[model samples]
Target: MSDDVYTGGCGCGAVRYQAEGRPVAQLHCQCTHCRMRSGTGHASYLVFAGTEAVTLTGAVRVWSLKGDSGTDKHHAFCPVCGIPLYVTFAASPGITAIHPGSMDAPERFAPGFVTYGLRGLDWDRLDAGLTVFDAGPTG
Candidate 1:
């Protein structure tokens, strides 16, 4: 991992976080749930280790939802700002999916891949060079 540290927070500054080392991967997810949650063409995320890597400040509200795979996914966001920050899967505790847009400098990490390609909108086109996955790579 690169030595760079990435810092980010919620829109209202109610929640802040700093992650050391470069992200393992950045993703653009076009899944239906992501579209609804982000209210955009796709949701951009940065993946990182869950343990001893993400240092967070302030309180965040969590909401659990059943994923397409029939597993529970806990999404954490700032209660004050209501900005989605991170997501954790019940089946995988070692990884965290962070919304890149919540970061202080989202442009520092461009999405490296696109997921749930089958669900992508017909009008949107992600970068052609990035790898495309039909579903979540976790499964």
Candidate 2:
């Protein structure tokens, strides 16, 4: 794997993806949806800035829901093993965010911030040095 390339797949290897270039953002999200889906207090992600640099293979099932901001958030998972892989946002058409745990090299994930801080659980303490946001960051 190249330094600038990231490769990963579902637990069953039924779905796979390759993303080229550096990630735009890396975060740990504590939203209700993330917590429930991840079966944890938070879910970590690497957000690539453009979908054009990403390639996906194999079959996946997607489900969408309105986010807190009222934007449609589509989650893609492997239909065979039911492992969540990535997500696309209606508001950010070109962006793709993948779960760090799904990466072939999860050690590469370096979260820079925490989203939905208000929803974070005290027991699920994260690095205090990381910036925390009450909601998603906006330009």
Candidate 3:
């Protein structure tokens, strides 16, 4: 794992987090579940391996739901600011999706892929060179 550490928090500073090592994947998910989760056209996700790589200093209100793949999705967000933080997929304990917008250096996130491209809104232009998958690609 790369020794690139990222520290960030919610908008209200009520939820702080630290992620060590490089992210497994940086991608844009345009699936329906992501749209609803992010309250937008799509969601930006930075995936990391294992919860051990992430440290949280504040409490969060969790919301449990199922993704389009029928896998359990647990989202932790700041109750005070109502800003989404990360998501844990029950199907893959080793992987967690952290919101790049919550990062101290949001500019550091460079999406290498685009998932659920078929469902992506036409108006939301994405990088044409990125590796893309239709209806999903998890990893």
lDDT values for all models: 0.83, 0.91, 0.87
Clash number for each model: 0, 0, 0
Candidate 1: the clashing residue pairs are none
The local distance difference test score of model 1 is 0.83
Task: Give me the displacement of residue 103 in model 3, in angstroms.
Answer: 0.4
Output the lDDT of residue 76, model 3. 93
Off by over 4 Å in 1: 1-3
Question: lDDT at 116 for candidate 1?
Answer: 84
lDDT of 3 by residue, 53-91 (tens): 889998999998878778888999999999999998888
Q: What TM-score fits each model? A: 0.91, 0.96, 0.93
Spell out the clash pairs found in candidate 2. Answer: none
lDDT of 2 by residue, 1-139 (tens): 7889999999999999999999999999988888888898999999988758779999899999987667899999999999999999999989999999999999999999999998899989999999999987651
C-alpha RMSD for every candidate: 1.9, 1.2, 2.2
Worst 10 residues of 3 by lDDT: 130-139
Indicate the residue-level lDDT of 115 in model 3. 85
Candidates 2 and 3: which is better by TM-score?
A: 2
